[model samples]
Target: MQYWRKPLDADKIQVPHGEIHIVRDRCKGCGFCVEYCPRDVLELSKQFNIKGYHPPEAVLPEACVHCQLCEMLCPEFAIFVTLREEVETIES
Candidate 1:
């Protein structure tokens, strides 16, 4: 299961960036997302959600490769990642 795949044309990708959304109420505090994150982007937050469970926090948003490993591993389907717009540099 490859989440992030680099294109053959390296120049197409400008910079790595993405956003993670965690549905707090749906989280069971299983720590799956935090543990499976390849980049250690997520952490179990100190704050508890409505269900009285700790949800995942994007501690390292910039480090996230948007792999979606967290989403796949989460049994509760509490988290997902969305890729940010690429800031492509026009080659002069």
Candidate 2:
């Protein structure tokens, strides 16, 4: 089985279609989520979690493209992403 794959182009991915959820307590301040986020959506928060580690925050909420890099790369299972359904447009 192929275990490695090329990273997607963030510019080609649609934006404003998703959101990320942070499991603060589960995070260990590993920074993988922030580092691998394709759209630079996440950042380390100044505030600490109950574990006394700085969890990542969705700093650029509008830029998120539901690429799931943050969710996949996080060893601590701290963050996850959800994609919004596309709104259909009706032609007049």
Candidate 3:
């Protein structure tokens, strides 16, 4: 089965800078998000969250491409990706 490769227009396929979010309380520490993120943006840590499990961390925020695949694959739905506002450049 063929799949969408993300639209190409700058408006629809914008490569916006983005960030990752981890819901500390809801994470189950199953490592599902850590393993599935294509960009390898997440990592398992020795530190634990309020729920007592070692929640996933955004170890490499710069590596994220805002694909949202990890967020969709997470069983607990505790992960989210937020796009940062583009910094408009001024040309002299």
Candidate 4:
């Protein structure tokens, strides 16, 4: 949750903007992200996968707080969160 508010240096990290990759086959739909994420970006899908379990879906990209808890907690390692600078506005 706190990481979302922190700014990352471009030289340190280079990743895509607001991109969260979720693999359906790998997801177990445990809803751990749903429980851990403060921003509530992930949600349980109604449809079931081949494994007979509902996978987690990124319903809102903007709502992601970039906490990385989803990535850490995922037992199947199905989620990826990449951070990138969307703008170059100087804050005073």
Candidate 5:
């Protein structure tokens, strides 16, 4: 999705990034998060958890936008997203 013109504050604006966390044993393999993620950040893992269910894995951890959709949609409350802190370094 490219724009013909970029926003004036584009350089100043910071896009929120997110880090995804999954509770493997708590996941029931419903795949709600994988199916509904807007960024396609999650995928069903081939390995089974303690409960014999394939939990979701963060296949594209960098793509998350901190929307929290995965956390809200998970039936078992197994997934959550946290805002990733950006450390800017000052160049001498």
Candidate 6:
């Protein structure tokens, strides 16, 4: 997205990141999570799960913004997202 002017605190503000977890066997090949993701983060996997259903995989894991939309939309409760923690290292 382009803007004429950037936000004054843009540099100071941090965008929340997320990690997506998918329970392959629990998925019913429903594309609800993939279809409803606002960031287009997930996609239907070509590989089939234990139940003979193509589960969702994170195609763009880094793009997740911790919105939890995929978790909410999933009918089978197969997917969920956790906030990615940022760790800083210090050198003595």
Q: lDDT winner among the candidates? A: 5
Q: What TM-score, over all chains together, does every model reach?
A: 0.75, 0.74, 0.71, 0.70, 0.82, 0.83
| Clash pairs detected, candidate 3 | none
lDDT of 2: 0.76
lDDT of candidate 6? 0.84
Q: Pick the candidate with the highest TM-score.
A: 6
The TM-score obtained by model 6 is 0.83
Q: Which portions of model 6 show Cα errors greater than 4 Å?
A: 1-5, 87-92
Candidate 3's C-alpha runs over 4 A off are 1-14, 87-92
lDDT per residue as tens, model 3, 17-66? 55888887888899988888877778998888888998888888866777
lDDT minimum window of 10 residues, candidate 5: 83-92
lDDT winner between 2 and 4, please give it.
2
Q: Report residue 83 deviation for candidate 4 (angstroms).
A: 1.1
Put down candidate 4 lDDT per residue, 22-91, tens digits, no spaces: 8888888888887787677888989998899999888888656456888889888988787756632222
The better-scoring model by lDDT among 4 and 5 is 5
Candidate 4 yields a Cα-based lDDT of 0.73
lDDT of 5 by residue, 1-92 (tens): 23477766666656678889898999999999999999898999999999899999999887788899999999998999999995222220
Runs of candidate 5 with Cα error greater than 4 angstroms are 1-9, 87-92
lDDT of 1 by residue, 1-81 (tens): 123654566566454456888889999999988888888999999998998988989898877766778878999988988
Q: CA lDDT of 13 in candidate 2?
A: 40
Q: Write down the worst ten-residue block by lDDT for model 1.
A: 83-92
Q: What is the lDDT of residue 85 in candidate 2?
A: 77
Which has the higher TM-score value, candidate number 2 or candidate number 4? 2
Candidate 4 clashes between residue pairs 3 or more apart in a chain or in different chains: none
Q: Which 10 consecutive residues of model 6 have the lowest summed lDDT? A: 83-92
